[model samples]
Target: MIGLVMAGGKGTRMDAKEEKLLLQYKKPVVIHVIDALKSSNCFSKIMAATSDNSPNTQSLLQNNGIETIKTKGDGYVSDLNAALSYLHELTLVVSGDLPLLDGGIIKDLVASYDGGAWQSFLVTKKFLDDMNMMLEFSVNHDNKECYYTGISIVDPKKISSTNTIKETYRIIDDKRLALNLNTKRDYDLLKGA
Candidate 1:
């Protein structure tokens, strides 16, 4: 399996002078993500999915010896689809802003995944409540409530012409999976943690 870290978004929500991924938190958020992926020891290779608008992010990753693939910079799905097209095998997709992500969480996600399904890591409703994160959409899986954690195990070959996929697997209730830094508020919360 290969690892793909998606970091191409403009991060308008962050309203920062610099890219959100480049903002420091002990280290840049994207670097923390890359370290997590590397420490997991799960993937044969790891690459960043970036875009033209994010030259600094791309350059930073390349300087750190991580390969990067340019994407459309349109939207999450579009960039993800572009990255998928470049990858010909099963790829583990991770959000670049998830600084709290660690190797153990990635290991658990990979180990729990059933090879047949398009697996996504999810945090249980209780986990979100404990973290004081606003509840977004929830799905009833195995009769339990869970939310997307922005991590997925996708098979590039399974992507359809319209950039959609069917069938899903959920790995649930990992608190470490809840720390996704999208806005300044989320970053503040992470800092407080």
Candidate 2:
């Protein structure tokens, strides 16, 4: 298994002068994610997926002794696909903005996987509302509104075969996975905490 941290986004919604992945809470946001992935002890190797949108982030990861793969600064799915092209096995994909994520949460997510082309982790809308977190987007999961946690496990080989793949949705009630810092409000909320 491999771990791939998706850190190439432009983060226009964050409205930050610096790249969002480089923004620090305790340390750089992406570092927290990389640390969690390392702590989980789940992957044989981990790499940060970067792009022209986040050159500083790429350099920082490289300087810190982490492997990195460069994409074309394309959109989310496109950039992920570009990285997946190089990763030929089960890859754990995580967003760089999930600062609160921890090793236990990641281990639990991986343990919950049974089998599928893709397994997405989500949190119910009610969970975020109770946490007073902002909801950027959502989808109908099991007839309930849920927010995608930006954590998933996928086989890169299976992705290119078709646009439609069997997806297994796992709803987790953990705040660590729910706090996606996508906007100024989300950042301020974390800062104020």
Error of 2 at 144 (Å): 0.9
lDDT leader? 2
Predicted candidate 1 versus true structure: per-residue lDDT over 30-146, tens digit per residue:
999999999999999999999976889999999999999899899887898888888888889998988888998889888877774377777777778887874345777777788
Question: How many clashing pairs in candidate 1?
Answer: 0
lDDT (CA) per prediction: 0.84, 0.89
User: What is residue 157's positional error in candidate 1, in angstroms?
Assistant: 2.4
lDDT assessment of candidate 2? 0.89
- Runs in model 2 lying further than 4 Å from the true structure: none
RMSD of every candidate to native, in Å, equals: 1.8, 1.1
Q: Give lDDT: candidate 1, residue 38.
A: 95
Query: Which model scores highest in TM-score?
Result: 2
Clashing pairs in model 1, backbone N/Cα/C closer than 3 A: none
